[model samples]
Target: MSVYQVLERWGIKNYRVIDKKAIEEITLGASILATGGGGDPEIGLLWTLGTLARGKDVVLIHPEDIPDEVVGASVGCLGAPIVLTEKPPSQNVLEKAFKQLSSYLNKDLEVVIPFECGGVNSTVAYAIAGELGIPVVDVDGMNRAFPELHQTSWVANGSHASPAVSVDDRGNMTIIDTKEDNIRAETIARSAAMAYGGISWKASYPLTGKEIKEKSILYSQSIAWEIGKAVKKARESHRDPIEEVMKKLKETREVDSFRVFNGKIVDIDRDFGGEATKGFSSGRIRMEGIGKYKNQIAEIDFQNEWLRLKVDGETLCLPPDLIAILDNETGEPIRTDIMKYGYRGSILLIPAQERMRTKRGLEIFGPSYFGYEEEYVPVEKIVSKKGCQK
Candidate 1:
């Protein structure tokens, strides 16, 4: 069935059509939300653009618009972000995953949802939807990106990512079924990526419309779209892109975000090579303050995505809370996969979505889960107590 026919059948009238410009804006916003991870946007953008060029319409529907029983699944690249930059997916990788998963379940997927908000993952869902003649939902598992598969609102809210199909560029496939064990699913999936030479595409989390509406981060794609549009407008008007990003976060999410630091990278200590960091790009980065904040120092640790932030020995942001380091002028994110010395950026910190801070969430992706002894603290609370670094 056609996308419009499916939408009509579901009585979902309030939906948006995704075009190339929309894709660009969404990718921009998603990359920032990726928090130094999510791989290269160029890979996903080119793939999605090619799909659009093939005369396919990518429809985006709100989480609330679908019927209770409609089935949906997530499709995106899963691997170490740094490895993905060197090895982009082939044309049929994601397609193969979807086909295999659908065949396994003996059902047709009616919608495509992103597992997280990032450059490549954000756009890959659109490509999959266009390829399958279905609509992509404007929601995701993680509003911000994380490295592990189990670290998502879906898992936090009692949903599972099991029975997932992981496929490599060369057609090798691994099917992971852990039933209710999302963590085991992640372990197996990670091993598959390592076996596939550090990158793989996955189709997972087959959820009904009701589960998606209740368990996923709702309107995440819309939030990303508005953030991207704001940055674009700011650039076009020659206004400060960081300021625009803060304004848009408040306007869209009503969250109190902070510009934690402005600085240029001075040192990088990468923990690459060896099986320990095989499926991830782990590192620590140091930045020397600039402008009004000169002489102050900021440090961040990342494992695929930015995990912790400390400025001159004071912890400012921790796991689950977002830490985006964006280019000061263009508002583009400086991903861990591509960051280097001498790069200047403004660090933006936003509180994790409420869904990501639930009791189960804290136990899964919180600071302790990353081996930090410090407790997870909300970014707003930290800002309120310390009054945001000047």
Candidate 2:
């Protein structure tokens, strides 16, 4: 069935038309919610906006409406966000990635799911759908954003991210078809991205519609839209937009967003040397906790996304969850590419959902996977136990 018919049945007649202005706002909101990783929004936006100018519609489909038999996959650029900032994507990246993957699989794709709700990955899915004359699913792997490729709801549910096809703007392509192990797929793709100069176009996670419905986060686009609208409203009214967003997402209750550091970024230590070698960005950020957090210290270690967060020598946050650094003045999210010394921001923490805490999910993204000595602990339990919040 058509995506339009499905939305109609759901009483959602008007899916937000992502025009130029709306796309900008949506991208900003998505970036803020991206939790410090998703890739460059500008690159993703330019590609998507160009596709829109071609007079094709990017339709969104509800998860449940997709038939079980139809094959679906996600399309986006994969590589160092730093590299993307320097080398903008060619307009044909998504089309080429999808085409190559489809040819490799020897099957026509029925739908494209956005890997995440951020600016680039979110809209890139629609651009590919428009090019291929397919519908983009309304749901996504993550309602917020995560750093790693395997951290999707699909992986948590047992669908594999293997056989991922990655292509460069130069038309070079590589297909990774490992058995069900996403980390292996990540390693292969990361190597390809490095070989291709730190950035590569990727189409991944080919699954059936039924598999997507069962495993994916449904109606997440609607949730992002709501969060975006709330932020916009908060901005216009001169209120704390961050608080408004936190309230809307119920993120405060879910996890404690420490006003940990309000100071300038004193230094940034990047482990990968921005080489894009390992499919992950390894780095540490040092910030002097300012304002109410004055005279305090905050440091974050990252591998792709922020892994461990420490404030004043106390481990405040950990992985399998999210930590976002935003512009204190404007509330705009700071990307790893643009994060620099003297950039003042707040550290917001939100708990990972129960779905991500499954044995399988933990096995993939647990503390041990990242070399932390402690075992995986739910954010709620950790926060409550430490008295970080009442």
Candidate 3:
């Protein structure tokens, strides 16, 4: 069905047709929101752009616009972000996963949802939607990216990622149905990715429209779009993109954003091809203070995504909250997959969305889940206590 036909049949009045420019903007905003994970945007951008060039329609609809019974699932790439840079996904990888998951579920998906918001993952849903003639939902499991499959608003709010389907480029497929054990599903999925040479495209987390409205991050796609639009305008007008991002967040998300540090990367310690770190990019980065932060040091640890941030031995940001290292001049995210020494960036921190602050959310992806001994603390609290402004 055509995009208009789909919306009309569903009786949805408010919708947007995503163009190449919009996807590019969404990718940029989602890359920052990815908090240093989500792999590279270029891969997803190129795929999505190619889809658009083929005259396919990518329609985005709000959760409320659909019926309560409308079915959907998430589509994304899983594995080490760095490995994705080496082995870009082949065409039709996610399509195979989507089909397998739908067949396993015995239901036709009416829409596509992003597993997380990141560069490649953010665009995956749109590309698939365009391919399958389905609309893409503005909702997502995680407004930002996380490394593991279990870390999602869907799992935190009583949905399961069971009956998930993962596919590798060589046509190898695995259907993981852990029922309610999302953690086990995550482990199995990771193992599959490692076995497949480090990356797999996946379709999982089937949910109803009502479940999505209740359990997922609402309007997340729009949030990323607005952030991207704001940054684009800033670049065009010669204004500071980071400042523009903060303003846009205040307007759209009503959240406080902080610039916690300014520095140049001094060292990166990574573990690749290790059994303990298989299917993941585990690393720590150290930075030398610059500008007003002179003489101080900043450090961040990551498992595909930035998990913790500390400045001179004082912890400022923890898991579930957001940590983004962005270029000072362009505000483009300095992704962990492509980070290098001598790169300059300004650390930006934003509070995780309220949905991710639930008690179950903390248990799954918060500080303690990441092996931090400290309890979970809100980013706003840390910023207020320390005055994280420059």
How badly does each model clash, as a count of residue pairs? 0, 0, 0
Against the true structure, candidate 2 reaches a TM-score of 0.90
Instruction: Summarize candidate 2's per-residue lDDT along 1-390 as a digit string, tens digits.
Output: 544554455455545455676666666766776777777777677777777898766676567766678887898777666667778778887788887778888987778888886657876887777667667777788765665677788898899887788888798889999977788888888788888988788889999878887888777666666666777787788887667667766742343444445667898998542554365567899999777778888898876567788888878777777777876556778767678889888887767656667787777777777888877776656666665532
Per-model C-alpha lDDT, please? 0.90, 0.73, 0.91
Candidate 2 weakest ten by summed lDDT: 251-260
lDDT of the structure predicted as candidate 2: 0.73
- In model 1, what is the error at residue 316, expressed in angstroms? 0.3
Model 1 scores worst on lDDT over the 10 consecutive residues at 270-279
Error of 2 at 142 (Å): 3.0
Q: In angstroms, how far off is 72's CA in candidate 2?
A: 0.9
Q: Which stretches of candidate 2 lie over 4 Å from their true place?
A: 1-16, 144-147, 251-261, 272-279, 385-390
Candidate 2 lDDT score at position 5: 52
lDDT of 3 by residue, 1-390 (tens): 776787888888888999989999999999989999998888988998999999999999988887899889999988888789888988999999999899998898888988888889999889999999889999888899999998999989899988899999899999999999999999999899988998888999989989999999999999999999988998999999999889888899998899989999999999753468877889899999998999999999999999999999999999899999988888899988888999999999999999999999999999999899998889899889998872
Better of 1 and 2 by lDDT: 1
Clashing residue pairs for model 1: none
